[model samples]
Target chain A: MESKIRVLVGKPGLDGHDRGAKVVARAFRDAGMEVIYSGLHRTPEEIARMAVDEDVAVVALSILSGAHGSLVPAVIEGLRQDGADDVLVLVGGIIPKADVPALEQAGVSRVFGPGTPLETIVAYTKSHVRRR
Target chain B: MDERYLTLSGIPIKNCYRPDDTRQLDYARDLADPGNYPFTRGIHRDMYRGRRWTMRQFSGFATAQESNERYRYLLKQGQTGLSVAFDMPTIMGYDSDHPKARSEVGLLGVAIDSLADMEILFSQIPLDEVSTSMTINAPAAVLLAMYIAVGEKQGVASQRLAGTIQNDILKEYIAQNSYIFPPEPSLRIITDILSYCAKEVPRWNTISISGYHIREAGSTAVQELAFTLADGMAYVEAGIARGLAVDDFAPRLSFFFNAHNDLFEEVAKYRAARRIWARVMKEKYGAKDPRSWRLRFHTQTAGCSLTAQQPENNIVRTTVQALAAVLGGTQSLHTNSMDEAWALPGEKAVTIALRTQQILAEESGVAQAADPLGGSYLVEALTDEMERLAQEYFDKIDRLGGVVSAIEKGFFQQEIADASYHYQNRVDKDEYVVVGVNRYQMEENVEIPLLSVGQESVRQQWKRLERVRSERDGQEVRRMLEDLKECAQSDANLMPVILDAVRSFATLGEIMGTLRSVFGEYREPARF
Candidate 1:
């Protein structure tokens, strides 16, 4: 049986603004993926645990409250510690250009800033998850 | 390429609107006088002529102390009313020191974890003199309790206070995701507040049924109007189901809407909303008070419309949206800061945002009379079309067992999903032109200072929450939580219980945790 690309879309930390995250989840579903959306206020540990338990191929973290520095790294460390480093981790939201390099270095496969098209995110997830 | 090819609400453009087009619009029968029954053109006859719409700028950041300082600043700058935006942790009902609140202690908006935080939020500001609006929904009952406690501390009667609480939880299920309890229990909590505020806080506006988040979620103007009115009607049903008198609390019901980049669509939406709401209140709910029938609303410029690429252009976007809101007869308006797409708006950006409203009121001649576009051929046609479409949505929602059932079945969620998908497809295909985002892409990076909250601020908040916990009475905290849990199980209004918990220094997380045992967490259905 051909497998569907699985993506865990989550809003980690305390940010309650989930419009972008919810929109992205729908866009992924429309693009033919089994998307698991962990609703608001999920900790980094919860997200990583869900990813491993659900056996998802990619983890998309959306942070809009300017806590990317602390949150992105926490998720990365949790995935690494749990030996789930094969998961393609993606981060998006109101990320500054200057923080992209640091986020990439911390194991974020791609950092999509504001105004990124849903198609671009969809394309990236499809290509990356298939390769993995 | 004739302009006649396009109609206002997607109807074929007409050469001109003659008496035939308006034959159905009888002045005495269809269109009542301003401030009278079926208030479509304007709520009040005087409108801005009596007084300009209240300048309720939503402002908050960092700690309660910092947000309070900004509130004082805006009030001193001639702001008419106060609108508070609580931080993410506070909105989710988490104390600053909660493990979940790490790194988000005071980011996005102000942090109010308990009555202590609420007290600090209004420390120096006089509760009696200023009417404050809180943009809180899921934890609205708790926040309102805290606000009442603040007034009590100031030795002011609750009846003397006046303002609004965005207590409309239905929107949380559809557009926003800040909900705490499941739908049935959430409605009970909302109805409880409606019943309580009608008696205790007599002047308070119980629920501001909001389309703001719906628009922010990328819904069209018509969808925003449709979904919002559906949510409002659902609340009315909840109140009536609880055996409350329609005239008793309906007079204080209010609304909050979003003014997006689509100028004419937004104006048409506001007018259609009022007409639809008035009819629903009178015919459907049997409301007697004219005030109960009128749809008084507050408007905020679309935060999602602003872009980080060319930050300065957001000012122009906000100006146009604000103008549409004023022309559409908004009771209050909040202009989005240019830098909001990046972080919490900086001082200069907030000043610029406030000035945009000032320019509209002072220089732009849009607010000289009530509903300036009342008789426009395009606008009137658009209004009629929107009203028809919105009524269709209401009918469908009613068939789906109202907003609560629709939410559980993901009906509203699916509609917003489809609309958001359509919008993204348009953007990707270049069918829609977003100035700096799609049409005006530049090779060189734009130089603008992005506002960033530092890590130190979060650490400070953690310490503050700890100090409050250590200094307060622990035994009393446990007792209040017990009371709250018992009240959650019983038919008692949760407001007084929440107030007791907050006064006893119970953390937001604890109060919410106690209730979660009874309400249980909401589990959203899978989308396929």
Candidate 2:
């Protein structure tokens, strides 16, 4: 029997738009991954702390408030400070194309924009997550 | 390829619709003349002929001063009313300088920390001359108190003020998730506002029971209508339990809905909403006044419908959706900007969005008569079908011991998730075509300049907040907050005490913090 991959879906910052987060979380669940949803209004530190505590292989942070430039990197930094650097971080929501490379340089493994297929996210997670 | 034809709500659409399709719908009963009982055609008899719908643009970003400039610009451009959008921190009941509000201050909307900020927001605009709509929940009472304070400063009595507070917290639970306190306390606060506004702010819309966020959360049209109306019913029940008469508050009750892509489906949804509310209010709640049954709503173009691939296409999409709202007989409409898919709308983009409504009202002949598409075979059948589907949902909700219990059981969330998943599957399979998204591929760079809130604005906001805190009388602020906490503890209405707190220059976070001590915070149960 194959071990299920674990993923934590976090909504960082004060943005209340959660439809994308909820939808992606469900997609992960349906794809047979162990999914933990961090509810709304979570700070970057709280999300990173949850990721480290849960021992999840991947943490996907969703934001729509265009504060992604600041919030996403903070999440990455928080994870690094906690020494959970191997947790593949994926950013999703309404990210502009120009910000993709900056987010990648900031340590995000992948950035998914609006209208990206859920299957693509699941596939990316399955292939990229490092096994401990 | 196998044949596929269905509405976003999963209703099977026939190959063609004709008179036979609407044979079961009674003209006098279900399809009565405009402004009559069971107002399927429209709530107003003259509709746009009497007066065009209010072109209320929802605009706010950065600091209060900057947002005020934008509002003044919009009003100068022939915009009819003001709709204020507070920043995330303000909406979540946090002061601008709070640690949790870092990187989020003035990012999405204006950061209003105290009455001073609200005063700046409406600085030059007279409260008596203009109507304002605020999109703030969880801290709606605090925001309303600030608005009333601003009104009093302008020498406008509370009874003379006209505007709305999107104080629909139940939808916050069901869809938006911007709630602070738990469900029971939240409902109590909502009822308190309804009761107080019945006497104090008679012209003010106490609650804009919203389906807009529900639909934006990916619920089907039918689910949006059903869940929203269910939440509305919950508010009415809470008000009645508080010993307030239905007619007193119900007449001031209003609704907010989404205007999505589908033309006929969106129009039919609005018509069905009015009919169902009329029947339910008259039959179940025994609302005597005809005004109590009317479902006046504000429509906003669907933000989710906009695509980033070819942002220009969004203009056409918004125009179509705006037309649907006008034809659907919306009392007010907010057309979304084309560049919203990337960032908050810039000045040029927002102007075009508002102009879309202007062109539709001034040029397009669609609003020449009430219910322009009233007798269309397709529209009437769809309207009847929408009502039937919503009724089925109401029955299921009733069986689950009503909306509050159903929310506890994750009923509404599950339904929305299932519907969203189904729609996404269709898009993935190319069964449902969204131009510039799943099809009509484009390979060009997005060159539009996006709106960016600077760190200077955040710094300025924090400085102002600190100054306000230092200047205000500490003893008075403490006393007012204590009085507010006492009101929260007892069965008394909370609006007056909250007003006093605002008048004393208490910050939004201080008042909400006091209530949190008594009511506690809410954490939504994970369903996925």
Candidate 3:
């Protein structure tokens, strides 16, 4: 597929603060990836549907409202429902370190926290995104 | 040769700022009286002298009943007012049962779908007696309508309602992006409410024009002020376009600002914001109402400044920011819990956050006088510099057409990106110290408890939403939605129609989805 590297970044629950997510989207776009930024209050289903329709290679979920344990799995399930299991699921924003393993088990490929560098994210995306 | 001594926002501090530094500031002409024109010193003459700023803590949780209990608990703890933070589903205009709302019905903020939820959220809380501020926008009109519906049921006259809605949606495009309608239509909805509230809910604050989120998004104080005022100007223009007099609605217009770690810069920013807003409302919008010119704002301690490494330090960070907000003369405030960097604040942590405010109000003598830091040469100089920097940004944004155009061109996003990058680079290079995060590393096991909302909240909310959906009148909902779609397509404002939908138990998702079909989703510009 000769297209922009589409990534869908969303906030699954009521966490209205999107500073980190918006900054990440800008970082991705600056690194030459086609970013599809979903505004706040997105459900896992809406996000998965968007990822499918946009044919995004990566889905970055940002939840700061501390609803991640519930919302992260829902996003994974939604992706499965949309036949988007191949999409790399990356979760970030206020996630406790202890929840990382469970999130990984729930199909979140990677978890980034407050101190994660944007360059590291860009590097990871570039190396991991499967180019057609 | 050392730029290391600068303030957090990179404002260089001098060894001493004498009278020469503030010679340009004509206190009588530029700043004027504290409670008078410009309101640079303070909005009221007595300020904290007469009454302490309202300790309004933002509280909400899964389910309206649970949230109400929490609100009552906070009130019992000496909280002066109520600030409601709705859940993701509600903020995004989705009902609890919407497919998108599956696990998120009431996860973050309170889930409010109809008048029932609204009533439950405020149950036993006297609507007429206590002021409530709701942090909602995009569907603010719908939420306001639901609030009014609840008030009507309580036999409280609309005129008796005194509250504020975070109805500033322009920042949604800039930083948040939880907006439902397009910019133009969203502005229309905001104006419609402004016009309606001026007559009906006379004491209600129609919009809390904000710069809190902007500063949180990594912008400096100057950028926060510039972008925020530009958005406010857009709203003034929007109200004027609706054929409403500026003075009629501007008085009800309030502001919400973020108090960041930079104490002096944050204080100066607040002072600059007041003077600039007063001048603009008077000279630009031709407003005669003094209330219209005064920029009354609510301040929340910055959540971004909290470090996850040494979580305990957040208390200190919040105290500094909260004191700055008090010195800046905010009308009300919310201090972030220490564990905010970990997860949702638990009862214990939230208590401390509330106590932080209480201690400041009762113990600290900072609230003794209005704008105690008013005559400081350093603060005055910084205020002037901030104003000048902000005006430069305003001129640039105006040339790019307005806030909407700036968003379309990714102007604000790009600025935030650069600032975030700069801050991050400094952190990575050990140039900026974030205590335990990058410096003063401590090798120790975690001692503090991490607060989690738990899985039971999800299951319970899911069940409640399902019950509401199945039990509601389906036919009435369908009819109401059809009416809403019609109103959306027509020249009629969508507030009344949205109210009908909410009243008929139409879900948030259905309403927002209808508007999405009309406006289409916004595609953010490539800023990198």
Each candidate structure's TM-score, on Cα atoms with residue i matched to residue i, is: 0.95, 0.98, 0.90
Instruction: Please give the lDDT score at residue B36 for candidate 2.
Output: 93
Best by DockQ: 2
lDDT (C-alpha, whole model) for all candidates? 0.84, 0.92, 0.84
DockQ of each: 0.61, 0.77, 0.41
**How well is each residue in A14-128 modelled by candidate 1, as lDDT tens digits?**
6666767877888888888899998777899999889888888999999988888889999989888888998999998988778889999999999998889988999988888
- Model 1 CA deviation exceeding 4 Å by range: A1-5, A26-34, A126-132, B1-19, B526-528
Stretches of model 3 off by over 4 angstroms after superposition: A1-18, A21-61, A65-67, A70-90, A107-110, A117-132, B447-451, B454-456, B466-476, B517-520, B526-528
Pitting candidate 2 against candidate 3, the one with the higher TM-score is 2
Per-candidate RMSD vs. true structure?
Answer: 2.4, 1.3, 3.5
- lDDT tens digits by residue: candidate 2, A1-132: 778888999999988788888889989999999999998889899999999999888999999988899899999899999999999999999887788999999999999998898899999999999987
Q: Which has the greatest TM-score?
A: 2
lDDT by residue for model 2 (B325-344), tens: 99999999999999998999
lDDT of 2: 0.92
- Candidates 2 and 3, the one with greater lDDT: 2
What docking grade applies to model 2?
A: medium
Please tell me the interface RMSD, in Å, for model 2.
1.2
Proportion of the native interface contacts kept in model 2: 0.78
